[model samples]
Target: MCGADRLVKVAFSGLAPLVIEDVVVEGDLIRVRARTPEVAAACPTCGNVSSRVHGFGLRTVADLPVDERRVVVVVRVRRLVCPTRGCRQTFREQVPDVLERYQRRTGRLARVVGSVVRELAGRPGVRVLSALTICLSFNTALRCLLRLPLPPLVVPRVLGVDDFALRRRHRYATVLIDAMTRRRVDVIPSRSADAVEAWLRAHAGVEVVCRDGSGAYAEAVRRALPGAVQVADRWHIWHNLAKAAGKDVAAHSACWAKHGPPLNDGPLARTTRERWHQVHRLLDQGVGLLECARRLNLGLNTVKRYARVAEPERLVRAPKYRPTLVDPYRDHLRRRRAENPATPIPHLFEEIKTLGYSGSFNLLARYITQGRVEADRLAISPRAVARLLLTKPETLTDTQRTRFDELSTACPEMIDLTNMIRGFADLLHPRPENADRLTEWITSAREADLPHLHAFTRGLDFDRAAITAALTLPHHNGGTEGVNTKTKRIMRQMHGRAGFPLLRHRILLD
Candidate 1:
């Protein structure tokens, strides 16, 4: 072959075994005319070599882009007659490596499209491919994505399992991961015990399964692989404890509320207190919750909430003030006002504006009119206090530490709750002695007067073995939880247009 011909063959090496005839650029498309090599070809069915050509047929196929332009290849293939005695069948020779059977695109181009669709499914994929000069429709891109094969399932010894919401409250799916490698294993369609149990029964090599506090999962693991060690996730345990501590903090809101400024008498607070009185008055007069809701023109849930609260003070929340330009100069304003209570608003605004305040003069006037400047103390909510109690001491700032200490010493119950939270947090660090520590922690929790902690202790008692394993073993479902988070992002990218099969395909392959 000449130098130009050799270069052509070398440049388009993907079309190996095909003789290049001509290459031309027509408009925006690069069209290549080629022919299959005139060699002996094997019959696909009977596995016999055929040399005699029956005829020649032309096939046009799309290929990868060349110089930001679409490439179309027109190749002349031979139709040979099989030489086998029993099968003298006429068959078309195929270049399997170059193109797939009955497909209009080359294998390499199809693989490129598959990769594009795999990451950006449907409309986004189409838009991206279109931008790259490759023509693709939305449904076509999805079809390409769906055609991609899933990875082979290999059962890992240490498995991590977690569930993510498919539609949130209506539907959910479970994701399994190899804890050691952090690679996703499989995604089950449902988060049911039966679904998990069936999976475990199919793949039997799992020795340690780490999961959350889902009873269905625990039950499934117990039934399917009784010999497997179950490790409860420490994050889930801490989350449950935070929830319980939040309830405990809320129940004793009076203890902390007294330490702060007087209760809010704003319009919202007044409305809440009035509604609570109205709901209770109706309930005391032999009226149903639904009747109270209808008579008061409120939703049933609203009426139920009011009836559930024993005191209206629990319903009143602290004022949540949004940050403003005046916040930076609050200390200056407070100090100036304290020195001279009769300070003029105009004078104060001018002073702060010179001190780098960028707020409008009217905004300063309104802040003073609202009495926020005089009201130096801000009311802390039970949820905020609960967060302080749950947060690690090392992570807390000096201000947060002071607030946490103040809330901790508000009542004897608060003191006990703080100790219990600390004890439970210590058990989260896995050690040989954590099992004993867990036992003592549960005993102390049950002995406390906090009803929320009592319920939390009951959950620990029910899942004792798994909880013990979590406190002792190092296995965790952190990787599985991360997979679930990625699954959520994938679902969001698909925009809920695709079904479980496509979702599973992306979760496993992507």
Candidate 2:
């Protein structure tokens, strides 16, 4: 045999039982003409061996690409007759390894398609396969992906579970991961307690469950695994604390507003203080929040916000000024104006133009008319003060530290809130002593006049066991949270067009 023929045989080795006759390239297509070797074939229906040839037939199938060209294999096979009594059926010879029954592509080629579709899933998979000289439609690629099986389920000793949004507020799903290995186990379609309970009941070997402080999840775990130790995620606990602290800061806006920079006396600030007084007057007269909003021509939420502050001074804030060409030349304008209070507008514009001011005369005239030149320093908002209070003291910059200290010590209530936040933050690190510290912290929080922190303590008391375990145990849902982040990327890549089955499949296999 020629070396070329031997090389062709080796190239088509995946089609083992078929003999290569000729390999020819026509334009961009490579066609291989081959024939199945003569051998006895078993009758599939009757399980009898038959070698008698009944008829000759040709079958064409697509194979892997060769040299960036499409490959088509045409094989000649013989139909054999069954020799068994009363079962003289004519059955075609089969090559199970090279090609599947009734499939038009080689098994090896199908596997390659499955892998590409597994990663990219529909039109993207088709585009990638087409680049490799393999033709496939989007639906065909999705079919290949769906054909792939899921990984086998192995219950982990330490399991972590979390929920992620599918459509945010409308749809959500749950993700389970092995906390020890950080491998994703399953993706449940719904975040309801029944769904989670069903999943936990099926996979029974979990000894410890790490999850966020969702009441539904806690209830499901309690019902599904009565003996399993539940550990609340420390990050979620801190997140809940931060939320309550923000509300507490907002409630005491009157106190922190005094320590912030001087408030603007602009028209907006005047309107704000006027509205606050009007809303409080109506509220003080026994009017409902909605009724006060209707009477004052304001939004209900706006009325509620105004009602939260004790004094109208807290409602006055700094004007949000946009940048202007006159900003850089403010000192020049201010100095020149102060030298001669009666200086004409045109003279100031011309003087600053020589110093590189590129704005119009009307802009400068408007800037002076609006009295922006006399604007005071902007006051800090309650939200910003809340963030400053929650941050660690060592991480603050010099300027930030001064501002934090001033606001934190604005009133007795502010001081108490700051201490409470710091005390709760200290319990996040797991140690045996932290459990007792958490109990004491809750007791102290309830004793304070801070209503927001009182609600926070109530939540901690409701899930005290899980909260205690989280404060004293090392188990956490950090891995599960990371997997949820990855799942979000997958959902974005799929463009929200896929259903739960495809998403579940990718989460398990990818």
Candidate 2 C-alpha error for residue 356, in Å: 6.0
- Let me know the TM-score candidate 1 reaches against the reference structure: 0.82
Q: What C-alpha lDDT do the candidate models reach, one value each?
A: 0.86, 0.84
Q: What's the C-alpha lDDT at position 408 in model 1? A: 91
Tell me the tens digit of each residue's lDDT in model 1 across 224-279. 99999999999999899999899788867767766554546788878888999999
* Structure candidate 2, residue pairs in collision: none
Candidate 2, residues 1-510, lDDT tens digits: the string is 699777776778888778888888999999988888888988888888889999999999999998899999999988999898788579888888664578789989999998988778888888999999999888777767777888888899999999999888899999999998998888888999999999999988999999998888989999999999999999999999889888878766656664333446768878888898898888879999999988878899888778866677655543334567888887677677778878999998899899999999999997776565544323456678889998989999999998888889988888999999998888888999998898789888887867778878989889999999999999999999998888887887673355788888877878
Q: Which of the numbered candidates is closest to the native, going by highest lDDT?
A: 1
User: Model 1, residue 275: displacement in angstroms?
Assistant: 13
Question: Estimated TM-score per prediction?
Answer: 0.82, 0.78
Clashes of 1: 0
